[model samples]
Target: MIVEHAVLRVRPGQAAAFETAMAKARPLVTVQQGFLSIEVRPSCDDPEIYLLLIGWDRIESHRDGFRQSPDYPHWRALLHHFYDPMPVVNYYGRSIFHD
Candidate 1:
């Protein structure tokens, strides 16, 4: 599996709205072709930060598939505005030790 990771730095006073929007946005990703799973967690050290992890079948599944899907606009609309400086996403392949 491929893991997509991002550290979302939400703007101050936007956490509650961001979480609500995320709930509405989850379905947009779930219907994608190669989606495996997704998780969003708030940081213990900073309430305005969140960790986003999405599992996909391959890198192309996210880069070419979901990013090009019709639902992407909706996803962007629901969540993108909440970011302060925007997040940088990274991808990881299968674990080195977990096999």
Candidate 2:
């Protein structure tokens, strides 16, 4: 499996709206092929910052499959505007250490 990680920096005072949007946007991504699971968490140090972790079957599942799908636009519309500087997404391979 592959792990997709991104730190979302939301605009000030938009955390609640962003979380609502994310919840609405979840179905768009979850319906894609190769999707595994996703988790979103707010930072303890900074509430404006959120951690987005997604599990996929492969890197292409996100970059090529989901991003290229018809649902992408809806997903973007729902959640993209809340971002300040925008998030930087990265992918990771299987973990070397885990419980």
lDDT winner? 1
Task: Judge candidate 1 against the unseen true structure and give its global Cα lDDT, from 0 to 1.
Answer: 0.97
TM-score of predicted structure 2: 0.97
Model 1: per-residue Cα lDDT over 1-99, one tens digit each: 999999999999999999999999999999999999999999999999999999999999999999999999999999999998999999999898965
RMSD of each: 0.9, 0.8
Give the TM-score comparing model 1 with the true structure, all chains together.
0.97
Worst 10 residues of 1 by lDDT: 90-99
Compared with the true structure, what per-residue lDDT tens digits does model 2 show for residues 12-68?
A: 999999999999999999999999999999999999999999999999999999999
Q: Which stretches of candidate 2 lie over 4 Å from their true place?
A: none
